[model samples]
Target: MSIIEARSILILILTMPTLTRQGSFGSILSSWSDSNTRGPTISLHAAAKPLMRFMYHRQVLAFIKKNRDTPLSKPIMEIYSSYLAFKHLSPSTKTTILAELDVRIASRADANAVAESLLDYAANLLDSPDANVRISTWRVLAELAHHRSTATAVLAVQPYRRLVELLNHKNVEVLETAVCALAYLTQWPDGAQAAVSPEILSCLVKLLDSPNSGIRRWTCLILGDAAQHQATEMAVSGHLCIGLISLLSESDSEVVENATYALSWITYSSHGVEATLNADILDVIPALLKSPTPQVRRWTCRIIGHIALHKSRASILRLNPCSMLVSFLSDVNVQLRESAIYALSWLTQWPEGAQAAVTAKVLQYLPALLQYRKPHVTKWLRRMLKHLAQHEAMALAAFRTQLVPLVRLGTLVVSSMQGRYSALTKFLMWQTKARLWIPWRGEMGREVNDVFTGMFGGRKRRENGALIPRTS
Candidate 1:
């Protein structure tokens, strides 16, 4: 018997004696019934005290009232009686119960017995030949997969293979639900291990072109989740990255957001980065910059950041994201401006990247970014320009113009007002501000330091009052 059946019988069985004391078993049964047809006769083995039985009856009535308003609650209760009364409830009635169970599972506030019974029976329904049954089964299992505790609980009996098989279901609802269920499974590590296979991943990629915006969005999310792990990322990198990039042009703004998210994770790894570059994903950035939605622009910057990991600034330069991203730095949205700064920071870290920034006309708008008040953006922009100034070309460009002197004045005023400025801090600030010494860190810094050493007689000489080269 299902939990629903057992629970109803338990309620009626426990309350029987109280009714029995009033009259015969027939009268007891009649009182329990609607005075229409006879109710199920469940025999109870133990007897309880009169007061205890009354409380049990009250508890059962309270349970009935609590669930009465839900659409399927009546039939869920009536079904047990229907089975005892030996009547066939239509498929629609059962489906309604399944839908309600879905909501309960989603909210994590399920009736324990009902959920347990559904999990037990849902696997069998996957083979029920009826699409509705399969759809309900998928929905229930998907709901269970939504949470880690329930996902682990149901993993053993979750019909992992059957869920993947439904990806090919002719019914759109079944296919959508199947992909969504599998996507939710990917949230848990074990589920990701089970769901991410060569065949299944290829199937997921196929859904990217599903014409249905919902299907494309869910497919992107599923691939995105699996790609979080290195093993899965290495598995799906090449074709999956290509598929996600192609979706950047999708008319649906949300679809583009999810696709961008997927691309970001997929390309986060060195291997993934290599695969993405091999696929020439840089080709897509120029077009994405044209998207009307700022979110698309925001995520596009993130995607570029991940692809920048290989540190192939030249590869990035060929597509010229420097000018494009610089344009976003002035956007009113703080996030967009930050993303732009972050993307530029990566490109500016190396000499070739810094040169690319200059070549892309970043200097033309370099002064505008200083007006942005977000701390991180300002910091990244400073570092980016610091790296760019190391090229000397950028130094000459800024020093010859009004940019450097104004920035130096601002820094000195802030430092003076803050009351914490020191000799070393002032020297370092002036050096960075004028792009004189690159701070003795990386090859670029060391190279610039070497040049300063040659020009100034020695590094120590500058500390003794021999000033850095005159920008004039």
Candidate 2:
């Protein structure tokens, strides 16, 4: 028996446990490698891993490059070829190879060996019954385009057309790669965009709503990238933005985050943003503010801020669409709270009531924030203080009203600590100082004047009726 075959048998015997669990495939791989050292078996073993891996990856990609006709080796060769192509050089080298391949791809007769090999993978993959293999072929074809823009452009059309056919791919990897390829190809305005038929864009929008986060994220990024000028025209003509807005509350945080960022980009362009506004898709913004992930929350806030700044300036001026943003200030997550603060600050600069709505909502949280002991929490408080000072007219009055309660709580906590936890006492004292209260009682006395004045008008007396000096 050949060395590879014998090794394969040995591995199957000794590593049944590993093979059954698919843990490492190490024994199997080692067996195959051993078998490869033998003459004819070497060729067979070379194609074996590619074939097996292809069964799992389902795409003839950068694994094996043998050109056998069976379902087994073609996929293997496709991957091996890709591996060879990518390994030879960087993006620049790939670009150079692609540049050279373009002239040859123009006609069947003139096609160079490499270009034809790539096309062969593309065509064969499209014809394959396996959706994964077909999707893999599309990826290879798309990568081919990345090098030779000209050849890639020409090559991309058929693959692009073929991609639309695979929209129904059951495999998530296939669907994700296919749409991402389309997104990347269509980035250029020239030939790539021209190749995207109306049906393709429609299919892409459907994928945007796929329960799959990968699909949704890629689709949004693509649609958003394409939503410019003529690309915007094509996207709207195909009805894409509404679907994107629909994803604002997507269950996946990464999807929601990317979708929000993409939507923002799509809206920045005149026609793109106008189309979204005309669709009246503002209602989705508030819900995203409550996204469980901080990244999602931050992106959602930024997007809303962008929309309010540009297309929805009038809507923001009235604070009609920002009620959810005001509510976000009370979110348990500090990052989310700060995002809400930033969003409100930006909106408030334009709208009259925006600042008030934010301050009114945030003041209620001062009691809770005062009790928070984390260093990050203190940093957040400092940011809040800066914000309060910046919008002093709007936030200061509210901060002044709320500060007394917080200080009173802090004092109560400090007073009650009867040496039970010296560390806790030191931390609170540090917080009080970091929070800018050295002479806590003395500082509080002047600060409470505002709170007491609102309660006891004409309070010229300090209990004994001695005139209370205005400390401001």
Candidate 3:
């Protein structure tokens, strides 16, 4: 028929109120395939594909809107079977439907409900032989994985193995989208568990060198999350450490942030720490500590803290990060401040680090942190102050600053015992001093002191009109 006739028919179908109605929608689709309707020529049918796809998309959206306030299971399944599964629907049409669903999944509060219902169909589509279908499916899964409520559901379906398989796909877009899905999925503990396999890590490590910045960024994010697991941390400690450290110098800020975050987790192990040191991570750490991104700085401090927990304090001392870490105590970001305090806490366990921290005036910045209510921040802050108090100069500095009442008590306790205990005893004393201090006057103080004296195998006597514990 004529072009005008086709336009007239398209408008009539689009304007029909019943076109998107429950059962009538399928009848319209069936009309396109039936050969007996008005004897339309082959070219006329071919010419209507775009308009047909548009009508299908419009109907799918209208159907969703009409049912949006209600339970989505029946309507979503209907859309899936009618539009997504129809044999004659073009790949692009299906992709459009999935894309629209992705938008809804991302912006709506009921996204988990939609994702839960769509997971089975989406999982089946992941195995489609069509590359476009696979890419669209990955995008939908990625959006689903973004929600914590739906992330475990995504994991339960076990699509990670299929995602790993796509890492080798020749299409760069497919590889990028696949890694993006893995990046979101691995953020959860269960997802990370599924992602720690040998094949997955190998693919991720290879993608670190991908020419596409997004692949490298997503790969780092996946590795970073996966590296939190003990098995994954040790597995990533080898050559992967070198690859991630190299990415620290990349011009992309996201790659650097994620790479640093992954390194922070990996370096939690002794093996990982040694590998990172051998990789010269220290050389870049100073710069990363000053990174414009708060996350990068926070992760960089975490890397230093993990390394300091090892026997390699001497190596980290050479970096002299105490002043930088101390500076972070005054930072606006509470998390960065927490990370800095954590690193300083580990570093100051050594006498040399304590002295460096004193020289950096860490005491000046610490009093303000006492006002912060975060338990982790307070825990690390207490450790950092206690560590600083172990050294005489730092203790004197704390006394001068009148840092905190507890810190002052630590100073008095440590100073009273100086030259009386062995180095190991002194360290152990500081580690437990917080629990040993008692604020009572008279009998309570005496009893607490006696307990401390007994624990150290010492006897107490008056010296210069003050009680002193003498090791016997």
Index of the highest-TM-score prediction: 3
Per-residue lDDT of candidate 1, residues 1-472 (tens digit): 9999999999988888553445445566556465656665544433334445455445445644677565444356354233212223344444555665676664554534344455555556677656786788678778887876678766767577787678876668878998888888888777777767877887887888897889899998887788787767778676687788788877798898888777777877877888877777777778887788887788788778776756766677677677788788668887887888888877776776677677767766655666666667766766676566556656556544534344344332344311222222332333443332344355535544554445334443233333443332
- Give, for candidate 3, the lowest lDDT window spanning 10 residues: 419-428
- Tell me the tens digit of each residue's lDDT in model 3 across 1-472: 9999999999999998764535434476677576375664569777787778777767766876776566446556566656766655667767766776677776545566666567767666777767788788888888888988777777777887787779988778889888988888888878887777778888877899999998898888888888787756777778598899999998899989989988998899899999999999989998898889999999999999999899687788998998899888888997898888889989988999888888898877755666666767667766776676556456556644644343333322344353333221332234443433432335534544654565455665545533346656
Worst 10 residues of 1 by lDDT: 416-425
Sort the predicted structures by lDDT, highest score first.
3, 1, 2
Global fold similarity of model 2 (TM-score): 0.44
lDDT for each residue of candidate 2 in 1-472, tens digit (9 for 90 to 100): 8999999999889966543544554576588566565555447776775565545343332222233222323344354447334422233323333333343334333333444456644465466554544555555555554444345533534666566666767767777777767666656655346434677767876787688777778777666556544655545423766777777766677777777766666665555656666666566755665566776776666555656546466654553545766676667777666656556545654425436555357556556655656665554454444445444454445545665455345422444222212222232232333332221344444654555465335443322322342333
Clashes of each: 0, 13, 0
Which TM-score value belongs to model 1? 0.63
Q: Scored by CA lDDT, what does every candidate get?
A: 0.66, 0.54, 0.75
Whichever of 2 and 3 has more TM-score, that candidate is 3
Candidate 3 stretches with Cα past 4 Å from truth are 1-73, 107-109, 403-472
State which candidate has the highest lDDT.
3
